[model samples]
Target: MTVAEIFPWQQVLWQQIRQPENLKRHHALLLKGRKGIGKLGFAFGLTQSVLCGQVDAAGVACGKCQDCYWFEQGLHPNFRLLEPEALSAPGGAAGKENEEGRVEAAGTKSGKKPSQQITIAQIRSLDDFIYLSAHQARDKVVLIHPAEAMNTAAANALLKKLEEPPEGVLFILVAHGASLIPATVLSRCRQIAMPAPEHKLARDWLVRQGITDPDFRLAISGFSPLLALQHDEQQSAPHADFIQSLCVPEKFDPIGLAEKLHKQDLSSVTSWLQKWCYDLMSSRISGRVRYHLQQADSIKRQAALMNPVAVGFMWRNLAASQQLARHPLNSRLFLEELFLTYGELIRPVGSETR
Candidate 1:
């Protein structure tokens, strides 16, 4: 891995952040935003530029100098990347352009699932890296991706470092859920709420990546171009089937649908329903559907007959379901109940014939 390229949508913020004054003022930066919009890539690019022996007037790494060469080869003595073991595995999301960089493959325990949380041991082990003399007497950087993955012990350990700043060191923490981070930790870093590109910009980027019907892909993936690409490449068929089941709520089999989709990522499954329900509600109120662009006519017809109060309540209830989706004891049972509730909301008593 070479340096991560900053996306077109990120140009303005990139320039703003790359300013010498901004870099000098903040020793640590918390880059927080929705996932799949290149927050990791931005962090990676910033790391490279900071360590570059020859940075351009634009503050981008020249990629031709010794420091840049070592960084690309993952041998930069002054730089370290901290990420979960799962993400460092071969063929993991870390390998993708949308979410790049894994300094080295993490050692996995045989027959055991790789740990997801950043361990206290990992944070503690950073003392030498932080306090030691730099390889070239330059600034050292430590990047923690998905910083929300830090467990309580790990976070507390990191807080110690943040509380007493280390000279000549920079910390870049990338996170999708900033709320999960402890308040004290949050307060210590310069928090940057990363931007998502506008619909047109996102759709154009997806189209350039060879995604057909970019509007629907963009909408379904919450307007994130990288996510839209992932969805199109990985989940198009399953997502279409899921949407089809939702389109005909009266005839759909919640049990069967749940069985089919239970093996999938529950969080993603919940989001699909959330977006679909949102479209149903939006279509009824504003005569428009947001996520399911190709299914607008069906949504309009269904929304017209549905009880608005019931739909609203169900939509609100999905928020709680989303939380449970993360740690459901029984995936199939959880999804079955979810679909059954949606069924009731869409075709409540005396509303089917309306």
Candidate 2:
């Protein structure tokens, strides 16, 4: 993808990448942002640009160059993409162990055994790759997507290499949240913060990608185009329905809602909750709520009834829940607790019953 097509924030980042002076001292670079903002794509593109045999005026890699061709074909010896073995698991972090306290490898789509994390063993393997003379005698690029996925030991192992990287070697670390990374890791690298896209721009991009529903765009993604594409209308319908049910002044069923959500994957539940909070936040600000358009009147009424401070408080709780769900948490209990919190938030103040 062209730099302009990547994301607005990425285009700004490309300016820094294009200047050789900017690359002088920084060997390890960390690009961090929210998911679906194209951090990984930007990392890959940056790597290819650095290794490309031919570059255009914009300093973008010429697609037909040998290096670019090999990269596209996944045959570039000088380029490496490192991630946790379970590619689909969020942020590539290890999942919880089973009843016996034995950690299972994360599941892979190819049915290959899951790897616990990007282990020190994997980091050591890179030494063999990098220690060799540069493939093209130009630059050797290693793109470590979701660098935070490295376990503590693995991160420390990688840190040693980062401290004294081989000549002509470049390491790009991509993470959604840099807080997960250790302070040592943060200090060693030059950080590139990829901000979220503009809401209207992202919406237009999503519409071009065939997401036509305005409500869908607003609900699923506040300002990230990549996230907008990941949400499916079919899956979002139930979430909207659940919110509608809660908007009414009636007994809400937290257990039933949690069960329904448990049927879906953890990522979907997190996304739904994130979107729901955004919708509520938007409703509070705009005095218009369209996430559940059919229940707009009810939502408006509920929004009016709730205290703004409490709503803000609930938003923070939901964010915490999202992070907690990432690692080993009782999914059922987590959902139950979240919904119960929501129930309490929407309940009439000083009510004896919720």
Candidate 3:
């Protein structure tokens, strides 16, 4: 995968992090924003700038410099990237765990899928790296992506380090939500809000990538074009029938729909239903649909029949269903129960009791 140094949208935040006055006072940067918006990529860019001894006028790393070469090679001694063991890739961080003085996680060899967590052990491992003298004479940089993966114990352990970060240490936390970190930790860091790119900018970027349905993908992924590619926005033959069936909620056959949907994965089943419910809710108030841009008129027609209060309850039910979506229960029965409940909330006008 080709990694971008930074996206066009990140220019302003890039400047903020590079500003000497701002960079000097802050030991930690909280890169908070929506998922898949390139926060971690931005963190990598910032690391290059801070560690590069010969930065130019714009504060960007000069690609020809020694520091830049070392960083690009992922051999920069002062740089450390902390993420879940499962999420961590070889050479993405400084080096192998033992070689770079990182904690050797015993859990990786368990033969199960590696953890999706940055366990307390990972956080505590920083004790040696952060406090150690910089190997290359530049400041030490620790990049943490998807910071929300840290559990309660890990978050608490990190609070102390953030509060009194070691001199010459830069802690960059890339996360979707700021509140996911403890209040004490948050207060100690400088937060940089990364907003989704403007429509035209995101569209232009996606066009360069040769995406066919740029606008539709952008709409469905909540305006984060980068995230758009991760979802299958195209309605294929199998999903097409299921999607169309959602427009007329009142006509749903719980058993038939459940049987059809359970054949698909539980996550996809719930996500599509949740998106449908969200469109209903959005059309109820705004007369516009987000994900179902092509079916806007149909969505509005359905919205006209349903009361917002009724749709609100449907949304809550959908949320509950999503939370339980991971359970390996009888998928068909689970979906049948959900569809039955959905049918009630979205019953036709005349079907409502007097």
lDDT of 3 by residue, 1-354 (tens): 224268898887777677899898999889898765777677787888888888888788787788778788877788877777755643332221111112222334555556657789989988988887887656889887668778788888888898777989998898776787777777887888886688899889888888887887777666776666554543345466777787666566778988877866565677677778889899989888888888888888888888888778878777667766656488888888887877776677677542
- Candidate 3: where are CA atoms >4 Å away? 1-4, 53-56, 62-75, 89-113, 233-239, 248-251, 350-354
Clashing pairs in 2: none
- Model 1 bad stretches (over 4 Å): 1-3, 95-107, 232-234, 259-267, 284-288, 307-313, 316-334, 351-354
TM-scores of the models, in the order given: 0.86, 0.78, 0.85
Candidate 1, 230-280: lDDT as tens digits? 663466678889998877766788899999999887777887888888888
Error of 2 at 10 (Å): 2.5
Q: Candidate 3: lDDT of 38? A: 70
Better of 1 and 2 by lDDT: 1
lDDT of 2 by residue, 1-354 (tens): 212134565676788677877765678899887776777667777887888888787778888878888887777899877766665354333221111112334555786677646788878889878888987688888877568778999999998998887888889898876899999988999998886766676777677777777445554454456655755556767766666557665667888888877755555576565556555666777977644555566667777777777777787776666556656367888888888877876778778864
Candidate 1 has an lDDT of 0.83
lDDT of 3 at 2: 24
Task: Please report, in order, the local distance difference test score of every candidate based on alpha carbons.
Answer: 0.83, 0.70, 0.74
**Runs in model 2 lying further than 4 Å from the true structure:** 1-5, 88-113, 255-262, 274-300, 303-341, 350-354
